[model samples]
Target: MTYTVNCSILLTELPLLERPAAAKAAGFDAVEFWWPFAEAVPADRDVDAFVNAVRDAGVQLSGLNFFAGDMPAGDRGLVSWVGRESEFKANIAVVAAIGERLGTRAFNALYGNRLEGSSPEAQAELAVENLSAAAQGIAEIGGTVLLEPVSGTPAYPLKTAADALAVIARAKDAGAENIKLLADFYHLAVNGDDVRAVIEDHAKDFGHIQIADNPGRGAPGTGALPLGEWITRSRELGYDGYIGLEYKAPQAEAFTWAIRPVAG
Candidate 1:
């Protein structure tokens, strides 16, 4: 199986426009990222520059995220938020345009965190509506919409693969047939879910997989998670998609572990 770097977390020291080249320089031919722009819908020039940067770097844009609000500020997602439906809708066209330009097939739509007074049923309904719309737009370019289960954030729901798959099922039943799960091992492990069991049971259902070590959300060796084994098991279970290295490493040297062989 091939590996891809998550430029949003790796090479973050560089500007967004330069990350693709940095990832390329690190011997990665494919890269993924969250929404690079601060705005849900950025200016045309900004979009042009971003697209040009990836092309010029000669790396494949394997995956991208729809706008999820300001990530650094703790806004997990916008689509399922009670009042951000319009913002989420505005971002769909922009995300579709970017995916078409970059030939990215996987788009992750984060489910927003629960609100103070919001009903779980209401938020779930909104998620279904927005994700269905996103799936329709992304499907125009033959892309798949991804739903991920994130951990460590109390307000954000969907902490396990089962949780995400349930939502994906709902979206698919609602006419979004291209939706699938983004199985991030780090999040599942952090939430105390059995990573190996998840892969054994549902690897074939995954559209994409992301990885980081638990406890610190750092590079593989920085923490104690059987990342290499999990990766191998995922492939054994028929998941041939990209295994995105979505970890935090402050320096280039931290990636040296990637060259090491996995223990059997």
Candidate 2:
């Protein structure tokens, strides 16, 4: 299996050009970012230059995290953020173009916050409609959108594996095939669900997996989460996708723990 590093850990300090080298030096096969290119601030970063840097460093660009809005409002998954459908679609198109240039296979698809005066069922419908469009946009370029479930966030709509499954099932029923699930270990831990069972049950629909120790949201060994066991079990469940290390490694030594084989 391959290892990926989430660029969110170094976004504040590193330039896009140097990220690939940094990830390679840290023993990661690929690197990803959480919304590095926002339509609101596209000029702040250069997407094409970042792609060139990845090629020059001989590292793969894994994916991008879609952070459209806050949680609580059930608008974080794929519904809509601030009720701006056109802006959301435009941003997704830009991200997909970046993915295509960088040779990335997946992108994080977030559902925005909950809408005011909207019922839970209504929120789900909105999320599916918007996500289906986003997914279709991504799929045209040979990429997929991975829906993530966050726990305790403002968008508590998809806080569990079961929640993600239900959403995917609905999308499938509606003939949406471009969307998939991104299972984050830290979020799963926070949601208090069995990670192994969740992954096994939805193995086919899972496109990417991310990890961070819960409680502290640090490197895997820094928290109480049983990461090694989960890794071992996931291996058994025929999951061979990249395992993304998406956490704040405050100390240099913290990075060392990332590549060490997990204790089964």
Cα-based RMSD of the predictions, in order? 3.1, 4.0
Clashes of 2: 18
Best by TM-score: 1
TM-score of each: 0.96, 0.86
Worst 10 residues of 1 by lDDT: 255-264
Per-model lDDT: 0.89, 0.72
As for model 2, its CA RMSD to the true structure in angstroms is 4.0
Tens-digit lDDT string for candidate 1 (33-144): 8999998999999999999999999999999999999888899998689988989999999999999998999999999899988899999999999999999888899999
